[model samples]
Target chain A: MAVSNPFVLSTPSLLYALDLAGTFVFALSGGMAAVKHRLDLFGVLVLSFAAANTGGITRDLLIGAVPPGAVSDWHYLGVSVLAGLLTFRFPSRIREDWSPVLLFDAAGLALFAVTGAGKALAHGLNPVMATLLGMLTGIGGGMARDVLLSRVPAVLRADLYAVAALAGAAVVVGASALQLPAVPSALAGAGLCFGLRVLAMKHGWQLPVAAPADPPPGKD
Target chain B: MAVSNPFVLSTPSLLYALDLAGTFVFALSGGMAAVKHRLDLFGVLVLSFAAANTGGITRDLLIGAVPPGAVSDWHYLGVSVLAGLLTFRFPSRIREDWSPVLLFDAAGLALFAVTGAGKALAHGLNPVMATLLGMLTGIGGGMARDVLLSRVPAVLRADLYAVAALAGAAVVVGASALQLPAVPSALAGAGLCFGLRVLAMKHGWQLPVAAPADPPPGKD
Candidate 1:
């Protein structure tokens, strides 16, 4: 987005909101995974941390963001811990259905993608690298989550996960280049990505690739 | 290490040793984690995928490796499946020993660091970046391991986990530049790292960062 405001990224409260909400949702997803895996109370939080915050932490480390996400602020810790505890306290009672799980996960994914891309842009990464880093931040936690749970990655099988986050980041860069307002452009970019993902899920949409039976894969 | 034998990089025997050893050690660690978590048959293999090979897969993906690690090699799949089966059959038995687990994990860390740095060097990554990536590839699997186990990271906590890997990679690169024999230098690098790590563990050597005391009742 345009830099006219000069403080959009620097807003402390906004960062806190993103971190808290993101951590909460991520932690919840992690805890839920533990339920699926039939793990113990300790297992729930371990899965939560793996699922929720690793992406941003990985991104921060890669981009040379000193102290990284978990270390820079305690709010992320607070949210992750709370979500994990709640999930531990009431796994089945809290989330009676899978839809809420997916929705909250999607929201966290979208939020992290946009926020990650924002950080990448702030650091002046190449556009291609920026888009990739954003996608990585979005799905990295889930990948970690799935791996820990022994599930195939959600992105690999049949989801528009990475592309959604990539598109969101792409539009933000595109809009910022054209001098759009920071908040509106970010919202628009994030909204576009989120809307596409929701619609994809609603309609069971997915990317087309060669059949798995065929051994050969597509170009990188 | 010298360009005098560029063909050695793709030599069948060398590559085979690298692949088999890497897969074996990673699988051992993965299986161990599965036992710790008490996952079912499927869960054991699933965690193995995450713990054993995901680090190499991620490393490949980030470095623009085509087909990634999981898809490009059937050997990877074979190793994962075999490890999973082995884990399921002997979880109770395997869970008995600590020294064996650490030995396998340590060996895996050293091997992957060497190979990961070699790949990075092939891709012409700078020494600093290659060293960092080598460490990441070495520790990434373990980090995934610890996260799934729900503990503060072993590497992050103290000792020479990632640092040893970094040192190994650095030595490999330096040895290459000096026209040292690749096999001996590689072994030396690996030995230096693994030996130092063992020493660190035996001697209780680690850097300590002080934590803040809890605030009084009026504060957080």
Candidate 2:
């Protein structure tokens, strides 16, 4: 008996291309972070893979998809390795301006959010859960990279990072509810996410941080 | 037709007890870390759950188990929350002595390693992969906790943390190969792991750190 996997079925060529692009950009960010931290070559590669694939791998796992595409597919590995090598060889060129990396990271984040929600919906997950999963897929890679480097994940405290992903995912979920076409819905979701992230960066927008706490009660 | 899930079939009462013990102890450690970092109540609870269940959840996901026990079953959450509450209420009591926490942590590590390998084998994974999965399960929770707090995972650099788990898992695999009884094999594996961890702590043993790197070549 043949079991049907949604990943094997619904991955159109355009979506696949966008997935690879997202992987490449995320891997580049990981490689840049590794170089900034003065990690060795192997560490750079490891971070690249982790940052590029962790989110998707996590989403796959939650949905009962074993042997996640990042693990089983060679293209993901190849893209991650190529990006890592490029950043390692030309750190100064990439590091000269942080804006480009940030822009690409936003693009990667948007792509992941859209794809993740679509995948979750395909797997029969409810809209609320699918949106959350999509946001998770956007943030999970960067969180893993930061954790491996012993730093707090920027998504946990950054300006509208997760919020942007959630908004994008919600858009996709809403479009599906409205019986819209998948391709145009994805494009619109990605565009909204990318726009929100860039605008937040330009305007120095931020989430509210917790206020300092008063001293704890003595023996109460 | 009823499909047999390995998790539903093979979870003996004793193993279930051990799993809960591991979760509680790990959760305590997480709560202690949160208290030390001055995290709020909700933060403590989140860290506790993340540290207690990440290893098991990851293991189940890899083995094609959806809705991991950590998420599906209520016992794990209840135990984690109980431990977190206790630690939060009596922070000084638990934090005053580090040795107790270390000892419990070792016990939890051993339990997780043994169980992880057994579950992998039950799912028909090869011995080598099962052993490695066991080590990952043993270390994954602590790694998650440390990462959330922005610290390097102790397993990656500490004295024989992963090594002890691997050794324990290897013993389990070896015993199975020799057709030894499952109970004895589990006991032996857990004992070996616990003993090694304690000894390493007592002797202040450490893994070797990478040496400082030389200056990079100019535009090579």
Candidate 3:
């Protein structure tokens, strides 16, 4: 089998790359967040794993992939723990330098969106569902991470996060419909997502916040 | 063939009752928490649904049940939304009524623990895994609810919450091991769980907190 197509460099390898890269960056972000919250060492590791894998775990479950990959794959577990340990050891490396953190986070968000959509397609979901699942994969981790720290999910409150993921997912699903090679198509989607996220951060782009309404029942 | 077991006194009926009752109580708690947080209407409803069904959805996913029952079944959706809307409409009905909230919360916890274990057993998980899944089901909703509301999860900090659920699950699993009727075993387990939770609340029995530890890396 002379594999000339870049996509044929092994589908599993591409997926594995996406998963590990995303997991590492998200774990770092989660660990840093934990440090900011003054969590103990145990709390930091818990948050790291939760933030790194919650999205993939969620998507896999929704697609009927039992014993989610995170649970079954020792590699995912190892990467998450390593991220936590590194963050604990090198807290000063991340101090108020938000740009580097933002950049890596965007990379993770983009990669996960692409891989998530691809996985959903492989699992036989419709384009629309796959796209939505992809976006969920991108945003779910951060949501879990923030919630664990007792904060409103950043996805709901932050700038262009889910929207960017959606765009990336759409690209992946669209390319699949055109019969494009998987690796290149996924790379393009990831690039677009990462670019948009970075631009959004730089320009402070945000979805409009809902105006506060009157209190619901139980209050005067 | 005629069904002779007490467990068959309408299995679906018993399951439906447990599901609805648990959903209603948890939804109420979620709504009230939203009110406490002064979230707008959408926020309240979202929180209510998350509190009412996250646990079941989680368990179903882990067991390879795709499009979880909560997502596929409109009845569950309707009940959750109705609870949210009602809480919004009649907030006064809940004010100054801490005891009722506590009682209902305990009920939901107990029922969910039993049902969750039952589902896990049906899925062929080992007893230990089934028991853990049961505890996860009991606590998952409230943990999500508290996290969304930006509060520390009561399960981790509150009195005997997860422990009570575990005990209940153990009873149910034990009964199953002895080939007891499902209805009676479940009822016994739920009753024990509810009683233990109530006692814990009345006596302020809590899991011991971790001693305060020094900050992890990057601290002066």
Q: Which number leads on TM-score? A: 2
Per-residue accuracy of model 1 over B1-220 as CA lDDT, tens digit each: 1223352264445645765587677887787678777777777777777777777776665565656666777777788778778777777656577777777777877777877776666655555556656776787777676666654455644565666787887887777667666777678777877877787777877643222222222200
Which 10 consecutive residues of model 3 chain B have the lowest summed lDDT?
B1-10
Q: Candidate 2, residues B21-79: lDDT per residue as tens digits?
A: 98999898887776666665655765787788899899988886675777556688789
| Poorest 10 consecutive residues by lDDT, candidate 3 chain A | A1-10
lDDT of candidate 3 over B116-188, digit per residue (tens): 8877777777889988998888899998887776666868867889999999988877877777888888899
Q: Which residue pairs collide, candidate 3?
A: A217-B91, A218-B91
What TM-score against the true fold does each predicted structure earn? 0.54, 0.61, 0.60
Ranking by DockQ: 3, 2, 1
**How much lDDT does each candidate structure score?**
0.69, 0.81, 0.81
Off by over 4 Å in 3: A1-10, A38-47, A61-67, A81-90, A125-129, A147-150, A170-181, A208-210, A213-220, B1-49, B61-67, B71-140, B152-220
By TM-score rank, best first, the candidates go: 2, 3, 1
> CA lDDT of A56 in candidate 3?
93
**How far is B153's C-alpha from truth in model 3 (Å)?**
5.5
Q: What is the DockQ of each candidate?
A: 0.04, 0.16, 0.17
Residue B106 of candidate 1: its Cα lDDT? 76
lDDT of 1: 0.69
User: Which segments of model 2 are wrong by more than 4 Å?
Assistant: A1-11, A214-220, B1-49, B67-143, B152-220
